[model samples]
Target: MSTSRLFSVLDKALPDEKIIQDFSDRIWNDKELNGTYVELNNEWKFIPDNAPLDIVTKALFKEYFEIPFGTYKVMVAIGGNYKSGTWIFDSKILFCNALS
Candidate 1:
């Protein structure tokens, strides 16, 4: 009687290939914040794409947005608003007078 596991046999038959891991910082267009907004992990279930690969790819990169410094009531998630993450770049406005 043969008792070899199917996954084990598949692993042996498949060749390892280099996978390009390019992740964007912007959230994917889903109801849930699917980008850097959530804590990243390798344990994926009920999510699209391969769990391990998807987590690794998304977690590897980040995007920085240059937001003007001001109190902004920004919407984080759907109907979810927050004020803490707003950043103000006041230095640019302050230094512009010197250049003139």
Candidate 2:
């Protein structure tokens, strides 16, 4: 396996935590999280905004937006997707929030 593959492996196996998750789904043994980003129905249009809010809710929303101040991302990885203890997305870009 390549380095990227190894990282992917561990990310799925040992995703320490998943925060601020509202909507989520799993497909064919794949675990997914959603509703963290405020955006349209499309995978795109997820813009970032750091503003003032209550301490708690804003912190919760921050989990989804981990990149720059104003951008969009999808598939903010938390963990899960291993095959028999083989971790995937372990060290590559599991925490990467896609830009849109």
Candidate 3:
């Protein structure tokens, strides 16, 4: 997807709730990460791996945000469609505070 469109979808998915917006902006502006959304089973899933958006977001949260290392699944709706993924975050408190 185009960079503008990606940020738009990310904003819709994650919203502009303080740190969440910071995190989303980081992902959108990071030069090293060339991530994209892919359609799977009629849903768009962002999987964390060595490549793509999921891994990039995971790494950013871990290193930049200093979130603990673990896995967490988060889902958000964009334009009546759902986007879900597994994110790496060890602390439930941190997750709740950061994303809630």
Candidate 4:
């Protein structure tokens, strides 16, 4: 299945896409995040819905309230709480922010 939904959330949440990434960061649009990201790739199995994304991500790091998959200039997935805001933004946020 396409991970488009997951990517959408990440892109919307962050203020600066290049400066940061969020939870759900490890997962890519086309493939699973790499082994370097063991917590995401090795530990948690992906749940299909974004609703549960925050709860699951919280277990990893609460301070973030999200996940940043790769480091700067990287491929990442951002974690988001569906209750907090819209699932997708028309043009405000960029995919790079989600990948932060």
Candidate 5:
């Protein structure tokens, strides 16, 4: 799916902050998975195997709301082998600015 379409689906699937938070928290707290996430240049990126993409994608989607403006990158992999190149969230995608 396209990035915007993927995000739209995620928005529909997680319609509220509470649900997003709960789901993201689970991924953030996962012992094995949590270590896979990192922040670089204000962007949050995670490399996960294909099996966990759904959960990880949701977690990154939640990050879009919680963090200051930045990109979210996902790099899919398996058994320490990368399956694809990075998918960077569009910089043009705007979110509500708390300071505004």
Candidate 6:
């Protein structure tokens, strides 16, 4: 078969808490008829900063946050819907954070 690619950009508002994140994953999937599926691969790199702290505690669940005044680079690979091994993927994204 053949392959296709797609790309998009999104703006997400953070909770105001000191935190940053790299996100990825499938946007939609139709499993019953095996019709459609999307995949996202995300990566993040942060500049050295003292604002961010890594805290580890004894708990079943943990929360993560980014430092208030830090900058970050987020990269993502989006896979578009397709059938079989041929992949129809999106262009990709390199997002830079502008500290608010």
> Best candidate, lDDT-wise?
5
Backbone clashes for every candidate come to 2, 14, 1, 11, 0, 6
Give the number of colliding residue pairs in candidate 3: 1
- Of the two candidates 2 and 5, the one with more favorable lDDT, higher being better, is 5
Supply the TM-score for candidate 3.
Answer: 0.21
Q: Model 2 segments beyond 4 Å from truth? A: 18-100
| Candidate 6, superposed: residue stretches over 4 Å from native | 1-21, 25-71, 80-100
lDDT of 4: 0.33
Pitting candidate 5 against candidate 6, the one with the higher TM-score is 5
Local accuracy of candidate 4 as per-residue lDDT tens digits, 42-92? 564433323122211111112443455533233223333323356643212
Q: What is candidate 6's lDDT per residue for 1-100, written digit by digit as tens?
A: 2222111111223222223332211212333433332222563432222222221111111227655543433322222112334563322222222322
Model 5, 1-100: lDDT tens digits are 8989977876675544544344345445655753455454698766332322222222333452556643333322212223243754322111211110
Q: For residues 1-100, could you state the per-residue lDDT of candidate 3 as single tens digits? A: 8988876866565444533444455334544545434455697654222222221131112245646542232332222222344643332111211232
Error of 1 at 35 (Å): 16
Q: After superposition, how far is residue 83 of candidate 6 from its true place, in Å?
A: 19
* Superposed Cα deviation of residue 13, candidate 1 (Å): 1.1
Query: What do the candidate models score in CA lDDT, each in turn?
Result: 0.25, 0.31, 0.37, 0.33, 0.39, 0.27
Model 5, global lDDT:
0.39
Q: How far off is residue 68 in model 3, in Å?
A: 9.4
> What is the TM-score of each predicted model, taking all chains together?
0.15, 0.18, 0.21, 0.19, 0.21, 0.16
What's model 1's lDDT at 9?
51
The runs of at least 3 residues in candidate 5 whose Cα sits more than 4 Å from the true structure, single-residue gaps closed, are 20-57, 60-100
